[model samples]
Target: MSLHVTNTLSGEREPFEPHDPDSVLLYYCGLTVYDPAHLGHARAWVHVDVMHRWLEHLGYDVRHVENFTDVNEKIVAEIGEKGDSEASIAREMIGATLQDMRSLNLKRAEVYPRVSEHVPEIIDLIERLIDRGYAYESEGSVYFDVTAFEEYGKLSNQRLDEIESQGDPDERSEKRHPADFALWKAGEAHPEEGESGGQTWESPWSEGRPGWHVECSAMSMTHLDESIDVHVGGQDLVFPHHENEIAQSEAATGEEFAKYWLHVRLLETGGEKMSSSLGNYFYVEDVVDAVGTDVVRMFLLSTAYNSRQAYGEDALEEATERWERLERAYERATAAIDGPDAATKVEDAELRETIEDAREAFVEGMNDDFNTREALAALLSIATAINRHLDAREAFDYRGLRRAVETLEELGGDVLGFSFGRADDADGRVELAGDLVDLLLEVREREREAGNYDRADALRDDLEALGVTVEDDAEGTSYRL
Candidate 1:
């Protein structure tokens, strides 16, 4: 069966067809570098990583470009908190973001274009829009004329008239219409006059920064092509962000922006979508440390990317048990290859058929809209068969066991991005993750002894929310995760 993906543009589950049959151009709208990546960000990252892995597994040379919006007011807001200047703060947070990505064992994109570094490309794209009569400059700021693009709201499926104001409040008066988004927001004519306290580049409009929507368009077009195979992002960006991208990009190049638009749904906890605005986000680093990267991958990939996945202690514990089962089964299969029964060279037809079945199911699951949950189920079935064979140790087939081993590593590790051989740091770094709990308890203990009861209570409450229970005893504060 051919691979099928639910395209956001056509609102249909269509067959996978890259613009280039031999290669795939994938662009994921990455995080704005204001802080460390949260679970929401990690969810998108893992799914995109899986997509990359699956395409490469299918022999498609994937040129994936995931961008970082370093030129945002949010990065500037972190001046004193993260660094002294805009560049310094971006550098600090970008480093943390890259570290977080690495810790998750994500496949690095071909290029991670930063908005601050792509100013020239952004300006060139915006200039095209202006010259084509699709954008206008007002008060030194250039805005995309939403009305000019007849299909302005095509991506998001909202009429131009019904949409609310697009950019910053100061931009409302300068726009031809409230729905018109900024291609270039007017900034200080010089980098020194930063009331917004951000780095600026010299452009025809002003020494201003590129708007959020235009950054992706310029970066994608420059790195890949004006018309690409796939564009991936979070579900939340469907509205003004992606809609604006289609308008500005097509207006500039007069070509289709992206053929397939893939949006990953939100990760929720306590029935609330994990969001920064809602104050319900958990950092990717903290979670990875709590459970190893393998467990983290297992937890995220438990549900399909387009479906909502809940986050909680119960879910993670279940994923932990599942990973342990798969890992143990893998070890048993590997060890059996050179076991006491190795000389037997017995080929169990049943085991061989089971391996073939698992491979077929894995491929089918992957083809069916990248259904990782189903794919993982197929892998777990292999573990079950492997366990059954090893447990009934009366003349087991070493050849069959070898096939099972290869199947597990190939399907489980290669496509789904699981780490079956974690002997390196599974013992060291994962055990060290426990120290975080102890450190937090130490701080809470200080708060309690220092007579800051409210602060102590707040810490305990925070710990409880994170699935860690804090207990106070005659000895001291003890916690269980």
Candidate 2:
């Protein structure tokens, strides 16, 4: 199946073709270690994770690259407040961020390059841009000359004149254009120079650090090659960050940068953009702990990659309901399974065809720009069919059920990152043992009401042997794995 993605360059959906069919190179803008990741961060990261999983499912080898901005101004300020070394603080935060990613079931990228470790690469790219006359040094710091790159605002779709009006000054105060962004900022060796508060590095002009945008360019270019298959980030990053990356990377490599630029829409709350700086952010851990990981995964995957989604309590409830419906249908399908000989042949070929059509539509929806919303709708339709079959209690063909499980496993387990299996399935004996223990507990509760202590104690002992912990109170009894 041909993959389609909403290319931010043209603001249109188009068939996605990689530079190499055998291996597709993907780069996603990762977090800056100044703070912990919020829901906004998880939304974008999950979007990239689902996209990569879909590409891999479709038989493409993906070499994923995500970077860490361990050497930014934010990190420096944060480290200073702690009175700890910048290196120490940055390392601690990056490790914590990885732990959060792990909780989300996101695999570590094939290459997680760090900006601090790749300072030389950033310097080399800056020098190349300087040599090419697209970047210039002013007041001992380098700034990318926006006018030198004619298509500077192509990715963000922002006109240079428009951004220029918002006039933000950098070290290049004498720059002919106001929209020009810093490639490097010059500072002093000591904190009292009215420059960067003593957080300086030895560069050609003075001590300082690379800008936020420069880190992605150098790291992505070094790891994923100059021209990548796809560049993904949140919609908020379309401006300035990704825009500058395009200018610097293309200017240095003299090649077209990323062919496909995909931007996931931001998560909103109360109709406003959710932001960590705004103090209106949710972390992935909270959601996963409140519900299960599957519900969180479904909530993230329910919306189209490019469409804004308002995440709230209602949205999470809807996700939980949908997850339960799908899982219940799967469980029923498994229960109805018989040996190959006794499998009931579905009489309505049209019903079977409908199931096939839904599967095809799901793939088609996902293939078309990762439209997970539409794909999930297709799955929900199949779920309706499964419920209809169950309601009728008719001898339905197992083939359709088998196909449904396969589709759920691929779309849910693989692409959507939902764990569809029951918790009891984790251990082979838990399903039966758990059910028997629940029955025993119910019997024990009845016996306790009748003052039959001896029988209740015996039943409790039986449950204990099966690794079930029973808690008794005035209300009743409860069990745990």
Candidate 3:
């Protein structure tokens, strides 16, 4: 099946076809780097990461870009409170955000253009809008003339009259229309009492910084094609942020800004919206540390990307258990291979058919608007079948089992970006440890066979002391750290 996505602009589920068929340009509206990232930010990026991985899996060269708004009102406020320079604060927070994303195993975007870095591009775009009569300069500030853009509300699906003003009331006084938003704000020593200061650049209109909306428009167009394959962000950005992006971008380029718009819904906690102001928000790092990276990611993906997800301790606990089940099934399937020639061995037709069907179902779910929740269900079904088969028979078709294992790894690890192995394995230490542990287990087996029970017990104790739990079962010795 060809991929389908829900386009916010068209309000329809349209077949996804990029301007260039061989490659896809994706731009996700990234975080404003004033503070540490929370779970909501994590969900939005992870959703985009899954889509980016899936696109690559389908043979498309994806050039993905996520922007950082390092120059913003919030950063200025933070600077006042912390007595740190805006550049220093932004650098620290951007680093922290990247760290959180990496912890969740999210692949970094090919380009992470910062608003401050792209000030020239933003100023140029705003100048084009002004020259084209779509924007006006007043008191050194420039605002997009909403009246000039006939389809100003097309993306957000609100009529011009029905939509109320979203800009600051004080800023609105300088705008031609109340709904018109800023392209650039005139530089000021102190816009607010607590604001240390905002970054400014010399522009035709004034010495000022790019507005929040204009920053994304400029950065995305600067790095990607004018008409990108996908533009993504949180659902809250559907209005104002994304709306202004479309208005400014299309106004400047006279072409479609993005072919598809994908917005992931907000995450909730304890039956209420998760908000930093409410003190109910969870940081991505804390969640990952508490429940493990795989569990946190799986929990987020278990919900449809476009639907609000209610998160809690119970949900995380359930995801943790589910992750364990998948890992156990993966281990069993891979471990069933008895010898070096296991790959050449044929499998039962029934097992192969089951795996093939599950693979199809998984692909189908993904193709239908990247339905990760449904795709995850398909994966769980595969795991369940593999577990049942392994329980029924100790020795099964090695090739079929291996095929099943590979499918799980491909879908879960490669596509979903979940790590099934030990976190410390990134540097190859896990493999070395496994080999050493296996050798010790073999020696312990030899000791047991030679009637040296005390030595075997001592070996087990030593392994336990190293945080490896060795269990003896019908399937011989198994160890986990």
Please name the candidate that would achieve the greatest lDDT relative to the true structure. 1
In angstroms, the error of model 3 at 271 is 2.6
lDDT of each: 0.86, 0.79, 0.86
Q: Pick the candidate with the highest TM-score.
A: 1
Put down candidate 3 lDDT per residue, 295-326, tens digits, no spaces. 98889999979987988888889889888888
Cα lDDT of model 1 by residue, 197-305, tens digit = 7888888878787888999999999899999999999999999788888889888888999999999999998898898777889999899888889999999999999
List residue ranges in candidate 3 displaced over 4 A.
Answer: 189-195, 338-346, 424-481
How far does residue 100 in candidate 1 sit from its true spot (Å)? 1.0
Q: Each candidate's root-mean-square deviation in Å?
A: 8.4, 10.5, 11.7
Worst 10 residues of 2 by lDDT: 189-198
Q: What's the TM for model 1?
A: 0.87
